[model samples]
Target: MTAVFAAPAGPTASRRDTSPSAVPRAREFRHTTDRDEAIDVITEVYVPHNLVLPTCAVDMTLAWTPLRHLVLGYLSYGAESYLIAPKLETFYHVNLTIRGRTGSQRGAEEVETGNDVGLVFLPSEPATVHWSEDCMQLAMKIDKDGLEAELARLLNRQVTVPLRFDLALELKKPKVSSFVRALQHLRSELDEPDGIVASPLGVAQLEDTVITSLLLGQPSNYYDELHSSAGSALPRTIAPVVDLMESEPDNPRSLGAYASVAGLSVRALQDTFRRTLEVTPMEYLRGVQFDRVRADLLASDPETTTVTQVMHRWGFTHAGRFSTNYRKRFKELPSETLRCH
Candidate 1:
């Protein structure tokens, strides 16, 4: 059974329905004879596979489960075909061959993947995948934004750059192999009639699990940052302080208050902040406060909201120093910003 449930069309879309049966049921195509129809269907739901069909009759089974921000597909076809995708710019495809063999090329690197070796296709990379007639693959598609968001959460930072992944996955390693096994288990649970995935919470948890597993198992650009030992505790400890500063930038803050929020002594907090962010705790706080003040200055009516009002509102007691810092950060005078806006 191929389950391809179209997620609701919005940012907060999921497959969960009060009546579970109302959810889009899985569909399967067994021994599909029409080559053009197969190509069209696969291209629409899956990636565009400019399939090179053999002269012999095409026989294949295609089944997929499309959950929120993720899709699981199973394909077993006796017809040889090549999956030619120049760039998968939206999602990350993790192709695991359950039976038989396949080969893929991304750039100059080409290798054969079978039951042992899984293949990962990132959004930034182009791929040329060729599968043998006897190949049966369990394919997983992860939404790009969801995965990146998860990575950012785990790393305690905003991911401003594209995440490029390693193409070939050697699943012999315990962590990699465990991630594949977990994926298989989740698929089995979803396949059941009364599976937990019928609930919204279940779907969300499963999405998180898949994304977290991939982040931990796969190597990417921020891999070193995640696994780094330097100031490891600082990032976690300072996260709350950063959140507080961002959320309530105008609120009066001091090193002692931030230290309490971070559950560290003032001295320890200062040292950690300097090590992790190369800025003192007060310096970081000042930056956030300045940003808020500048936003107000830019958006406010100069007639109603003066530089003095904005500065005092954001806890800047001095006019000259505030102007100096604001100019340094925005490369423009606060007065200029207010006048222009």
Candidate 2:
């Protein structure tokens, strides 16, 4: 029942792959020999399920990297298994068995997944799965609520119908392949200790990109509406707020204040921002402040000026976070900017 949320700190798994597609060990890791403990580990990431293992000796390995809107996991039961789970309720999962094979059934739909082939499990259906002795699955859990909310914001209207996706996920298709590649890129880039996603802007942008791509490219019930949505008009909706951010780089405003300027509710303003700029109003303002801070740092004499002073003038109070964002945005540390100047 040992679960390590950070990178693995124990002996290595000889079979673990170093490929970019694999969620790095630096993600959350868990391994167990006890049957109940193994079940608990699985339930920790997913909903409770009835796990009928053929043997009393259970060995399971679980690894996951949880993000703001989704969770990426790798799971393997080193024995034959059958699991019956209730309606997913909250999340939609895409399962790809990278080793051996898996059989899944929901209602009348049945799928055998292996290698590049995958099956999408909708939130509305109960599921049953059979895992082979050597099976290892790259299980991706996407936040259903967040995804639906993204779709609504993009179309700028309420979504009355269930967002059911086509069960078969053809990974070989150019669009699906590109979406998978983007997730892999996010895993690699965000796993670093001081990765670019440390900044609010980077996090918002990546999360938005993931949700938007999935909604647009995946065969969903909302396909036609998404294609016809007035997403182009969103830029105009948020332009006033952006103008305010640019005009008053040093001014820090709450979400409500900014929304008032845009003549929309706080929620609408935030949604419009993600749909248009892939970042929130606050993140955009922070980026503007960083630009101003960099300007001050470059023009001031290093002997008389300080990074802290310039940062405070731009309303950046957190030294470590500010430096990380500044470095990511400018490709160098703020001190480096001042030193070189």
Candidate 3:
């Protein structure tokens, strides 16, 4: 029970020719206008596995006018011998397996991509693909910058780190099914009269929805040190403190209290902060509290909540100090963030 899915003909290409000179070169594959020619060039450069590729169907559509966008592709391959170009380009890719087992090797690590996992690949680096005997994959490609910007907004911080292509997170069955349904629906809309106008919007919404679900579904412990690794020396110690200050801004804990909880002497913590994050612990805490206050003010109903009320709620007791810090952190006055309605 092996299957090999073929790429559709329209404006696409498959790998074709190879020569001795093209073997395992350490250079990126240049972008190509001719899809088929590019595929041929790629197939020639890489070594193919000798196995019977399973049975699968693949349908792909490219939106090249506004931006480079790939609609969706479904692939199921049995035990088949095929060569995947070592270097593959993508703006961004989301892949989920529906059945069987598939594995990808990046650098020195090998990761299994299966029905229980969803993987995101960013445009930072090129990677090679390999699969097991029986595997089914559904993938979507999208604009890298657009996806990054939207993720930053949702997370309320910059999120431009490269995705570890080999990393795998458990995917809930509901999300896998929902993504498939959305892809099918998007494909159907692509063939309609107003398909052009509606398809892009639908795709954008679907991308956002799926991303949101994935983020919310991630284990909290998984992201506990997200900010700690950004050149922060005391990432282990400072990360939790920052999270705590942001989550409980009104707690009114002093620097010493935080240091005690972090199991560091005040001076040791201060040195780590300076060495790692290039800021004092108090300064970082102030920034965190200000962010919370600003967010709270922006989310509050102005008709029901006052600016001072929001400020005091987050431990900004000194109006003058609070205003100064708010302006410094957000470049806007506290009054400006609140909703007039």
Off by over 4 Å in 3: 1-70, 76-79, 82-90, 132-134, 163-166, 173-200, 215-341
Regions of model 2 farther than 4 Å from truth: 1-23, 228-341
TM-score per candidate, in order? Answer: 0.64, 0.61, 0.40
Candidate 1, 191-303: lDDT as tens digits: 67578877889878877887787778877777777778652444778889989876887775778989999999999998887777667877777866876776687679988
Model 3 per-residue lDDT tens digits across residues 239-310: 677667657767858989989877899998888777654567777666556666766775788888888988
Among all windows of 10 consecutive residues in model 1, the one with the lowest summed lDDT is: 9-18
Best by TM-score: 1
In candidate 2, how many Å is residue 68 off? 1.3
Could you tell me the lDDT of residue 159 within candidate 1?
51
Model 2 clashes, total count: 0
In lDDT terms, which candidate is top? 2
The local distance difference test score of each candidate is 0.71, 0.74, 0.50
Model 3 residue 238 lDDT? 64
Worst ten-residue run, lDDT, model 3?
A: 58-67
